[model samples]
Target: MKKMFNYYSDKYLASWIIKFLDLIVVFVGFVLASLLRFNFEVAGMSLSKLLEQSLITCAVYLVIFSLSKTSDLVMRHTSFTDIHGIFKAVVFSLAILIGMDVFLYEGMDYTGVFLIPKSILIIQALLVMLGISGYRLAAKSIYATFLNSSSALKSNVLIVGADVSSLMTKSTLLNSSKHSIRVIGHVDNHPKLQGKKLDGSPVFQLDNVINSSFLKEKGIDEIIISDATLGPAQKRAVIDSALQYNIKVREVPPHEKWVNGELTENQIKPVRIEDLLGRSEIKLDSINIQNELQGKTVLVTGGAGSIGSEIVRQALFFKPKKVIALDQGETPCYELGNTLKKLPEDIAAKCEIVIADITHFRRMQQIFSKYKPDLVFHAAAYKHVPLMENNASEAVETNVFGTKNIADLALRYKVQKFVMVSTDKAINPTNVMGASKRVAEIYVQALNSQQNSTHYIVTRFGNVLGSNGSVIPLFQKQIEKGGPITITHKDITRYFMTISEACNLVLEAGSIGNGGEIFVFDMGESVKILDLAKKMIQLSGLQEGKDIDIEFVGLRPGEKLYEELLAVEENTLSTHHPKIMRAQIQPVVSDEVKVLMDRLHEKVLHGDDEGVVGGLKQLVPEYISKNSVYSRLDKKSSQAYA
Candidate 1:
């Protein structure tokens, strides 16, 4: 019994001990085979007669097992390769046994004396294979059970699904001896899997799993979700319930993120805010987008920025003739080049990164003159609200003057479509950044005409989760620093989308637009910043106010408590796509928009920020400043209106 159970150790059983055990099994198997072959006629097979043949059989198998190194593998971790080793040993031993059984010693007159008779050798071979495999399998199963029940230090983790993925995750965690984790059970709602036993653990329903008191009973320290098909909403629900129960929850990393293309225990991590966005996958009108961009030379201003870079990446898939990644930042432009080079050589070669400023008319004109782009995506602007509030003139220079240059050049060069990347903040603007973008939106929307060859389109969206300087990254860094995660206000809320999803809709909306359309994306439900901060803390495996803290910093200049996607007088009409809509708002004419842009441009040229703010109010009458010095301009404009 000790020989049988000694295989359940931290290290592998000794090869010599393994050989001794295998020979013992071979000797016993031959005796059992002799009884079965002779119909249990033990009188003919006396112990004295069997002893000599059993020793010879054990010696032959011992030699075969040594030569094949069949005992070199860990019995408790036996795989098919180890089983194959046993098969080779069995066949080689059988070859020697058959030779001895058939050999006729004519000189000694022993032709009838068969050593370990032919019938017994055949029966023993069948018995040996079954016994060897059964021994290893029993060892493996017992070792697993021993590890599950014997270790008081091991953590008990409950798996969140009963699928193939969950099985793999369970095997990975259980096999990692360093982690010392025992999977308590699986939680899933599939009707077929319910009440089923996986690795001797129950597969229970996920409905009210946290409330079931099963976790407390089992002393489950963590919950691991490994189901790939589980929707984001379902995942968030599980995570939320687990957090409330003080049960740490982690998700198995996607297969692609596995290190060296193999899953490991360390790779599993807590689900991030990005994972819970629950954003539906955006299905693109790829054929329509291809028809619009195929063989067309495209220009993406601010191509190094978040949204601009993503558009460039997606647009290349449509087989554009050439894509010009125009941005002023030399470093980002170089980085973008390196990124583009990772694509197929053909697509990478079709891309060119130009270091140029959109605000400089001569530079942009030179680009427009040389490439004569058929389509342009303008993503460059001063987007930081607080920073722009302090530097209103600079925002006007880039957002206003830069936009005018791109629109005029697109019109002059007869570009098919010009898509301007706008923000939801542009609607009913309350900040200099939003007002500047609104001014640009007015300019671009005004430039589109019935007879004009160029069609100006605007795609407006809310915050993208992983964009540079976005809230999610900010909270992550703060949590990493082990400090207070700062929020402008507890009640403040914002809409969010993934960077890829936002850019996909941009491409989709650009393909389907005619001209003079401000397209708004369906940015799903808003998220409260305070709640977002708390979740980030929990995901970091830290308790709020104990391991970390959430600091409510007052709202910054020009920051609003709530974000709006459409203005008070404006509503959206659905397009062919469910997520995209055309804003039904009054469009300004070119002549009128040109006059206000000229005044804003003159103020920008004179470095008169106040005059620029005043001009912006005149351009967008609904522009109301909030918690900003520019709020005085709202009053001034309102008085003038009165």
Candidate 2:
């Protein structure tokens, strides 16, 4: 039954069959009405006369219908064009019939008029319209029934948001039988849309359908969020409601992803943990940006990762002399290299991917000598909080010593401007990663102040969504595995930015830096971790408590409940990028920096964990420990005393 009337099931043949059926309907309707009007009695009328009159009427009707495509089966579907065709066909056919009876066959139709009364003619036309329209509607109904009954095709869904985007979504859903999901209804925050019907599906308000009882009543197995106008907080709230009901959720991507006004079904992707991050939209200051890095040779270390790759992408549009991509990761480098080559051939030739580790001072020195880069963006760092907490010594080597090496090489090689990427964790740091990053900032700021040779600056931002080791990817994987997604804490919050937006600000900051400045890109606000996880689960087409579960793990070592963008003593000055502010505080660098570096180098070389820890604390006095048991020693001679 389902396969018989499918549009693709011998469409040409079906079209012909429908045309014949329509012709039969037209002939049968006219003949039946003629018989009923005359009571099957015609005085002085032979079978030949009746046959001739009926044949002439049928011929006239067919001619008008054929001219107007009213009898065409290919147009069985109800569309504006089809309606127009029906109107034209009916009007022309009726005109011909009335003309023949009144003019050419005046006396002949006097006999035929008795058989075909005006009432009977109207009745025949109505029957004909129903016969044609009924077939298509019946076919659609049958198809829908078959699709709904199939376990593989059935999808239970609840819509989130009652905005224009959601309305557009509902329109697409009810009009198309191809979509597998059965829209259970909407769950919206707006009061006006609460009791309204979106294409016949009820709009369940937030309070009406957030709990277990309402969800059970609605039979909502999934959720869809169609509102892109929602702020990060409201978006998170809607996701939480779905998660509480154990309903799967889906949503449209942000405006950035919707290119050229096309929002295809495929673009409606599942929400990820990154969507839960509460960084406000970045408003780019194009006027100030045009004055910076337009044609400069920009080198981004670790250019293959999320943040670095984004920087490279945004920088290419500026028509820079060259974007030197540096990273040690093979796969990401290759992928980025291939992607660069495929970009408009002119831009492709300017993007260069180099595999290098920032930790190796000699390697960085050689690269600087070779490239003579006008500007350098040093973004390579070991930034995982708990992991860095466990391996504080490694963190120091990479974050602190690696930064020193890069700054020194940039200065030696006469690099005009250098920008160091810093994180929010660097402010009043608790974890080793944050402390090491803070120390690195001090090292660069000190270098910037000490010399006029190289303009060294630091740019600080918070977490980037979809970056490697980011929580977004972790939640997605957990959802795929069909189990509990672990969040550090319910109240744990952190600042976030889209990877591309973060990188754009980084470039803008580098251009604004003269020397000895620490710039902070305004991360809008902090977002809760638990809420993010639940949103991710909902967006992945899984119910939170039913299909998937979220578990709260205790805070890891050296982790803070919330992250800060600036240190307590630091004040900000407006820069070229409106969102980015330059720290006005002077960097205090003791002459003992080089001496401390020498001892720290020895401790790292000999693999003395205690000496390395002690030296780091002595070098960075602001270093603090949290949720870690590695605070047994003090700053004074702890290495030698051990």
Q: Over the full model, what C-alpha lDDT does candidate 2 score relative to the true structure?
A: 0.73
Count clashing residue pairs in model 1: 0
| Overall lDDT per candidate, in order of appearance | 0.85, 0.73
Please list the residue runs of candidate 1 whose C-alpha ends up more than 4 Å from where it truly belongs after superposition.
1-151, 208-219, 256-261, 637-642
Off by over 4 Å in 2: 1-142, 145-247, 253-267, 389-393, 488-491, 540-557, 573-578, 584-586, 627-629, 635-642
Superposition TM-score, candidate 2 onto the true structure: 0.70
Instruction: List model 2 lDDT by residue over 1-642, tens digit each.
Output: 555545353444355565677677777777666666677666634556555556665677677777776655443233434655676676677666666655644655455422444655666677667676676556645544555554365667777767666765654444344666788787776777767887678887676565447766767676677866667676776666666766666687764676454355666666666655645566766655555666778788878988888888877887778889999899999989877776899878888888988889888888888888877888878889888777767878888888888888888878888888889888887777887787788778778778898998888988888789988888878888897899878899978788877887887787667888888888876778887776666566566788888898888988879888777787888865578887777546646676777787787777676676677677766666667765665434544522
Give the TM-scores of the predictions, in the order they appear: 0.81, 0.70
lDDT accuracy of residue 86 in candidate 2: 72
